[model samples]
Target: MRVGIAILSYKRCDITRHTIEQVQRHTKADHELIVVDDGSPDNTQNMLEELGVAYIRGPNCGVVWNKNRAIYYLHEMRHCDVVILLEEDTFPMEDGWEQAWIDGAKRWGHVNLAPSHWPLNDRIGGTGTVSNPIISRYVTGQCCSFSREALSVVGYLDTRFRGYGHAHVEHTTRFLRAGWGGYIKSGRDHNFYLIRSPLKVTCLDKPPPVADYSKNGDVFNSIRHDHIHRWCWRDEEEMAVFHTSFSTLSRSGIPVPTISKRQWFLSDNTDQNLVWDPETQVVISTPDKKDERPRVIATVSGETVQFKVLRDQTFWMTWEQPGEALLKEKRSEAATFKLIYGKNGGVGFFYNGLFLCTDHNFNDHIVLSRPEMKNWEVFHFSGFSDLEQPNNNPMRSDRIQDWPL
Candidate 1:
């Protein structure tokens, strides 16, 4: 039978690589492995290319849509008999691990190969030697398998669940309601080991940095029992969070009405952005938006944030002068700033306890003209995130590529 394996990956590059490499080296199943990347701003795209596997990298479209991308591609486009879904954190164990899942899917139509199981098979070293039935209404998306019949009847994941949490549960519940039989419990045998990796710094804009489960949970609870999905997922508040996640600011970007003296706001290309010349390593004073400029990147560790100017396709320098904002090629020249968050989903760059500002007025140049976390000092990073970048792209073909199936 033709097998299609889809792996869902987020911001963790090291863990993703470790998972994919394990699957590649151990599994002997005749399957096309496809990694679905949720527009990670890291080297995830670069890592996938080095692995020489098929992948689709798109913007932060939530966990529901992320899984659906792989499901739709593997099941609908590739016409695989059985499709296996895996997350980046799970590692495949032993050789030909796909056979048990294939056999299970062939028998049950759909099955969830539970990754985080009981203590018996929790750690390393367990062949999925035996198979047992899991009496569950829905299956988890961590590591699962589905037959063509299941895909044909159930379709892709319910995107109404939005980014994360209850999406998998709701989708599998629908399948079970349609008589897909009991989900698989990997028997006493475990195919994959779920490893918890450290969360690194990421530019995540979906499911929120810290997911508000109540909203999506209410969504799942509301429509879970309906035989048919005729109801729309958008309420006014839900739509704001669903469509443009940053439209509603998180508590971290909470309202600080007290210190906000001037009005801080989101920046776009329409804003008077600082244009840097790569050759001169200086910020161009020109107001023209058409001119080419190097990408300005920022990194955060602990409570300190450092800025870098991407030149010659490499991070070559730091902001040398606070007043002129000159990019200088020296690590020592790097300026560290503390984030003074504002009410309107922005932050004021507090360098050495002073706000980087423009004299409490929209000036042609930014200067160290403020001392507090006010409007003139505040600038939003969420406005310039990849969450809006790839999602705003009108073409799906631009983000997806044809890989060897």
Candidate 2:
């Protein structure tokens, strides 16, 4: 399917840069990206141009209007079969994630690509080949894919709505009202994992102009707001956590076989035997083998929440905890960790699978600033997958000669 990505960006250049670069980097299918800049006073246009991004600078119309303009640009102007709508703040976690939503849009009508596990799946269940179903009543537009057929029926988002409150919801309601079905691909899936950008980072030097939330709320209430969406999932708040394996985050996309049912001791002198369950992604402190279950000391995602092991010796991963907390707990005071592969070929301890920098020295301790094939980050996998950058030699003989697991 011919997919098009439409980003409605006002400011926040750093976030927008990541959004665009990552999307362009991972997308393998035929697609185009059009960033609609809603006339930001900041150097948004210049920044996008410098990055070789194609953007349209529209008038300082509110968020809703800018979104409508983007839909028109993608669906009507470009004649794309599907348009993937992304807000500047919504970030994707997996590579080639758009392919799933694109496939979903062909089967379902409107696909909410970024829905967290809020409304239950059974609320609007499926009739397609894939298991993930479409929500018939409610949908959000953020990080969503609209089929050309779906847009032809629902039309553009209502330009009457002033700001950023319920344009997504109102547009969704119109689709359902028009006898079309809406689906939400929740972030809980491994392949479709997406998360909101961390709020702590100061991306922009100055605060750019943004619509007032209270005013947006006032506008939403002032209009036709009593749309009945059959409520199935009624969670108060939705938490987003990264779902892909650590190795996948690397620029090279190293394939690490999921470790399971093995007792692995840390390379350090500490007698810490890490027994990791690949399916559960959990580790317990040396199973007591007593009547009482072993407490879950840590998880592959790095959550340190202490809970009793279930009958299957697994614990439920809670979304309430942040993934960053888990990574930090795993790091601890040790600057490095060597995840040794047991009796599994030449697989050894690998560095954290984040982007690597070419200019800097090889330091396994820090997550690098950007993507490059400069550093040698290795870990052991039992079987073999094709190396993404086999020709780019980052491994130094001097550094890895003493490969002790």
Candidate 3:
């Protein structure tokens, strides 16, 4: 496949030159390099002429506009099979990097290959597939690859997105909705490096003036508003811990939620019976409630479980149980019974310690009663699977061996 590399450069001549050198050294496929100079004051055009690389120059338009212009030139003027976009700061690490994207495009027809450094921990910020491409509705434009078909269908980046913003995300969503497949290939480890410079100097030289999002609020607002499912910590303390955990997992590109003990809870009356050992990555919760009656009224094994906590408090567990028929009648009548792990390692209903085989299936609900606990708080856990053996798997627990990392 014919691959074209388009690097969007502003005033950073040194970084742009380095990126070009790296691409030439690592890429094995036949490719043409095009650098779009967005009216840079620096000697960028002169350097590109010296390096013998094709160039496109335009008036001082915004970054997104410059990017769209370059893409249009590559697609309409050059007629390349695939276009790989990179910023001056990003360099490729792997040999045959172009081939990886070409191969991916052959399989998925339209794929997005991004550099490894793109943050994936945030649901909205990772490499994704077309089936559920975006955990949240956002995509990074820093470094990405696109097949010719995708470019034709999605067109160029929306010019309304002026400075650095949601232009790429909006484009990706449009492509996915049109029945095209997208995949994120982990770019070479050392192939691409984000040029880290002093923010003060960089910002002063070319400060990103905030755009009036309200003016083009319709497009920007739709993307921002659709991202409500993206997870957020309730407070500052939780956010700090999340950041640290996220940083560690980011190295391998495996996306997971940043979980914390603060977000977990046990019965209020218990003597801190919930044990969490970070060193071991295990959590053990031993019941301390004396009433011991089942709090769940009904449970649908793979769907939902409705149970009472305090008289006014109710808890819902989304999962399926095995023996549901026995409890079907009791569930309809609002019978009180606790669901617990049975001796046979299956779901069992319990009332006062004797495993009660009630007509209603009460196998998966764990009942607890704490009169002092007034307000109910939602505890967030990652790696929850309704199809898995234990539906409510703890995030930081060794017991959850089959949990996806």
Candidate 4:
């Protein structure tokens, strides 16, 4: 098989260089290497040049877009029998990794080389000294191998998953539906190592550039608006059995107004005034020192919930008590969040049960690091009303600019 390796790279020059160096050092088989740069304005181009590797520079098209481009380049452009996709953060851990994946690809059309929990089956042992390949229901694209024939069957990776979520599952589901089996090759010494993702910095000197909150939100809502139904399984209404609605919003004879405006909401009912300042908008600035930080408090049902609207377009919920005290206290106290609905009655702030609670001190907030909203993450002011007419821009004259960041 004519094997090709395509690395989807952005920012993080150091990590990208390390990943390339590792791939070059470990792989013993003869295969072509391609690096697709997603318009990262860094030393990425120069670094790839210094390393003497094949690369293509693309616009800031996002994760899935670049991934599809990589697949296209390797499978269609290069006419390879199989293409391997790797992110700058993940790289092979052992020699002959390419050969192992190529072998696995022959058995199963798709092979995930990264170490992740088996989607459907438990980890199985290989031989007395080797690990066996385990079948997976869904596999991420991080370090996965796909054959040209499999791509022909399942089609290319959907570039519509433009940002950092669900592309793996969506693509994997397609392969599964086409009767293509996905597998995990074990018995190799840790096949891959996922290094820390580049630190987000606003400065130009930083390796990877960080997009501002609004731009990030635009990308996020774009993906969520398009593919959320598939991600949340909205077609299967029977799965939403976890929680009940708030009595006030449900029973209030307000026609359960649909999310009409895109304004941010605070839980406090007493503060009717708009919280945002037009002159110097909320820039998501953080105090240099924790001790120097001013106290942030919001009242919900007469009790104070320590909350902060971060610059990244996500809110944080925290508690002042210690770990043990935090455990003993009712989940209602810290977790009890008031509805921060938009003017259109759409939920501006909510949590996804899947990616729940990123820990910053004792705070738990939705990880807005990515663009797609998890199934539990979305809610409507009028019970899925916002979702029904997602693109609708219902105007509310009374609404004011409240999203500070």
Candidate 5:
């Protein structure tokens, strides 16, 4: 599929230049990259000319408007099938990132991916852990993908969410409602590498301000106030936890499976050997002869959770919660689980999966709960079949070494 990328920059010319360079080196598909300079005083125009990317120079429009403008120019004017949006500071990890997203789009019709965002130490907002196949109400524009159909239906980022907070959330909600599936990829990190020019590191002592566009009677706030019954997922008590894993079998290649219902018990007495073979792509849970078999359940594929023992002997869980089901289930699908390493992890439900409302500590063991359901039955699946290994592992050391930093 023909893909396009849009990079929005307010005044961070240096960061924009670096981001463009990284994208050029890493993008593997035939695609167009548009850089929108929102009336910056810096030498952004000169940098774009030097880089030779499709450049749009406009007045000092706010973030929402500039983003919408870029979409209009690229999608409406240039006529691309898909658009990959990025901020001036965000960078892709490798050359095949675009292909991965394109592949996802081809399979699911609509998708959005994001990097992990860890709050600075001592910051009020909890440290952010990335989710795989994220079903959030909104995704950060730092790096995301949108199918042409999605943009055509959802229109653009609501300019009323001018400052920062609720705009992306509002736009994403509309997209989800319009039958778009959101995804956050795993095994990669969108690190906060630099805050080049104009954006600098201040004291990491205080929390970032929560943008309150809701108070101004924006679309997001209107829905929040007027639609009380539709907002039943807002309650905390109605929540459940979903978990899953992705593995590759030896003869088989990479198999993404959902963990079905299974109980697991760890005895206090003996040492259990948990094996994670990258070559085999199999995670084996072989306990000493005496310990109880932890009954752990997972779905093999398609919107189910999976649980497995990682290389470090810690348990890892990931799953995709269907946006439709989340909305129907008034209860939230939120829960905390103890990591294999004993760290805490969990995602809070907001308006179903349309938005990830909060992050909670999972160190303390908590019960698994389900969100309130209206009419749909929760999807369940059997374990995955063995996968076939490819002649060459696309994820190789040489390829990794060559990727732009």
Candidate 6:
């Protein structure tokens, strides 16, 4: 894969130059390397020019902005499928280290290639290969690589983070929520390490920039977001808004919930030959063609589950009278379902003690507000054959911010 290496450097001219040299010598891959000088005051600019490496010199824009510049330029402008970000202090130790990073990024959309903290245990290999990914939500941005697929979902770091602090953690959080697998390289040939002290300029023409942890920390604390089951993403639930409850699909990747019971997913009708008729307010036989059917999104709030049927327009399934179901334009009076899973795949709903089951023929209609769920449909999550509702959620893509230079 074509990799774009983004080397974020500052006033540490000697260290930055060494880093550039090492990367150019060891990284054996088809890649473009660019250095972003975060307004280095020393000889960093001149030294970069002397080395003949691609470098951008601008006013000190802090760690977050400079790193984003590197990412956007290399990933978008260069059209590189994968972008590997590295700090000047972080240097590669192994030859062909970029290959491992590329593999890690391809395997897990986002991967951290940072070195092991303790120097004594510096050799990291064996189980940490890309084939065997160790997934985690958090990853260090100091020396990391992200596939283009990941950048689309999580976007770049929040520009609000002035210099540095929590931007790495915050950005990583969004990527995990977006369904991109996050990984930290613990495998063989993993060769990236951090220099504890990469900056030392006592006698320079100008002083280098300093980081303000308090300011960055404040910004991070001010903009806090929670993606538990509500007010997070479209994939969480509240469908589209609790956004999509944490995610209805199970680890099996099937349109089923991980819990004992699943909610309703209209797509579940195909194999069972059953579908919910939004207009008629009943479960009917699945149509031979699916294009004729409309789009449906099931949402859950508090303890009630609501379905959004999109055809000519948005409509909600409502019960106007006992045993009479219809679709309404608004959800203010939409019908809700409570699922009750049976021993073998049978499930019933519960608002109070009310439950629904098919008639003696095990067909006829769906909602029969009764005393107990004696006749609850087996695994069939819809009407007619088994009007059971299973869990299925959705995800909405995040918009990227235009952090103007």
lDDT: which candidate is best? 1
For each candidate in turn, the TM-score is 0.50, 0.45, 0.45, 0.44, 0.45, 0.47
Off by over 4 Å in 5: 118-132, 136-138, 182-219, 223-405
lDDT of 3 by residue, 5-106 (tens): 888889989888888888888878888777876767799878887887766654444576567656765665577887777777767676765665555454
Q: Count the backbone clashes (under 3 Å) in each candidate.
A: 2, 5, 19, 10, 47, 24
Q: Tens-digit lDDT track for model 6 on 270-348?
A: 2333335656657543435453554344444322456655566767876533453467788887877654333223334
Best by TM-score: 1
**lDDT of every predicted structure (CA atoms):** 0.54, 0.45, 0.45, 0.45, 0.43, 0.53
Q: For model 2, which pairs clash?
A: 134-183, 302-326, 347-380, 348-380, 350-378
- Alpha-carbon error at 14 in model 1, in Å? 1.0
User: Between which residue pairs do clashes occur in model 4?
Assistant: 126-131, 126-132, 131-187, 259-344, 259-345, 259-346, 260-344, 261-343, 261-344, 352-377
- lDDT for 140 in candidate 2 is 45
Each prediction's RMSD over C-alphas, in Å, is 14.1, 23.6, 23.1, 19.4, 22.5, 19.7
> Model 4 reaches what TM-score against the true structure?
0.44
lDDT of 1 by residue, 1-405 (tens): 799988888898988888888888888877888788766769997887776766775446567756776776677557899998888877676777777778877877777653334333333333333255533322345677788987777776665665557776667665666666442244322222222211122222434333546667888888776653221112221111122221111222322221111111123222445445656545433345455565444444322455665556434334323455655566567777754434333445667657666442334445554667665565443223232235554322233232111
TM-score of 3: 0.45
**lDDT of model 4 at residue 106?**
62
